[model samples]
Target: MTSAPVDQQDSLAAWLSIRTTVPWPRWSGERAAAGPPAADGVRDYFTATRGDRDPEGTARVLTALDRALADAQEGRQLNFALLTGWQRYVLHRDPVGFRTLPAFAKGGRERYGLAADTAARFEQCLSQSTQPDLPLPSRAARTYLDVLFFHPFEDGNARAAMLALAFVLACDGACLDQAHPLQVTRWADDADGAADLAVLIGILISATQRRQRHRSPA
Candidate 1:
């Protein structure tokens, strides 16, 4: 007789336990230029990845990204409600809610367990996006990873993560011109990988700002 499939550890818990301990990189890079907004990496990601196969879906994601950016500009706090508003547009459905059951990803190699307070915990994490002490890149990276490991939505979590990352950066007056570099697989237990993501964001932010400076007239 074959043994039963082992229950995967809760990746969400793994993330929460180490979220604050990760050695997030410090960012001293110049902010994105105020004039002529930076190229939106989220839009590029969606268009290039899904434009051909699902044009309509791509359109929906772009719409959601615009709305999310608007909300960020208006200084709206990132929270479950804010994300759900975007998710409605993403899924083309009304009344999106947190998943009530365990969510799995990566071919079921990772599982996000749900508890009575999972939603509350997620909201607590989102609020930290505006934490005054942390650097923008660190906040952005943590928020992105939070969405990823939490697996809050039944579907479209990856889209949600990208949207959150964009919103975080936009709130801090930054945006990445290229996002393809961020498409790699992320494991919940890898603290070093999480820190590296912040470092990469800093590099991208600096590169985008540098390019903008070069293009600007003296």
Candidate 2:
């Protein structure tokens, strides 16, 4: 809930959480790279998992994620589980790909100086679930909820945060509007939490509702 426009000028902390062109995801060599025209490893992974969406398979995949989260919260190693979840979900449903959180790059530098607060904000988000009384954005926008509380990675903190929100939206029947490159660039320019969270949430919600209205019922 706590919806409202982001403080573009003051949101430096928010801006510091994302990634740039150099020194990509931490998993690049171990897995694949992040960004457009992904690495060969990424293409190969996608090729391997590409298949029809088996509802059962999807359910199992989701169950695995739940298990992974539980294990993580209980002090178990969950990097594999989280990475696997994103990979398999990408195979089962393209929509899920929008929620992917890139691994951290080395030398955690901050263009926006948010390192001190990333964990704090993430913890704050985890404490508050999206309650009925708390209006939310579209499903897609909300799906990234996982990354917010999970703190699954260190470098791509912002991506993780948004991904967490996107995940929440998807699961709650709200539509998600993957951030537009233009919008991202603009926000990047701010390099501050200057962006308005509430405004973005509202936009995502409205866009998703409009799209859902026209789709035939499943």
Cα lDDT for residue 132, model 1?
94
Following a full C-alpha superposition, what root-mean-square deviation does model 1 have from the true structure? Answer: 2.7
Residue-level lDDT of model 1, residues 1-218, one tens digit each, is: 11224676888999989887999988787667755435766789899998999999999999999999999999999999999999999999998999888888988888888899999999999999999999999999999999999999999999999999999999988988889999999999999999999999888888878777777888
Instruction: Tell me model 1's lDDT, rounded to 2 decimals.
Output: 0.90
Model 2 regions lying over 4 Å from their true place: 1-121, 131-133, 138-152, 181-195
User: What TM-score, over all chains together, does every model reach?
Assistant: 0.95, 0.37
Q: Give me candidate 2's TM-score against the actual structure.
A: 0.37
C-alpha lDDT (0 to 100) for residue 133 of candidate 1:
91
Measured with C-alpha atoms, the lDDT of residue 140 in candidate 1 is 94
Best by lDDT: 1
lDDT (tens digit, per residue) of candidate 2 on 19-105: 221121111011111221211221222223332544454354444334433443454322323443544443343323222222222
Q: Worst lDDT window (10 residues) for model 2?
A: 24-33
| Model 1 ranges off by over 4 Å | 1-6
The models' CA-based lDDT, in order, is 0.90, 0.35
Candidate 1 TM-score over all chains jointly: 0.95
What are the RMSDs of all candidates, in order? 2.7, 15.1
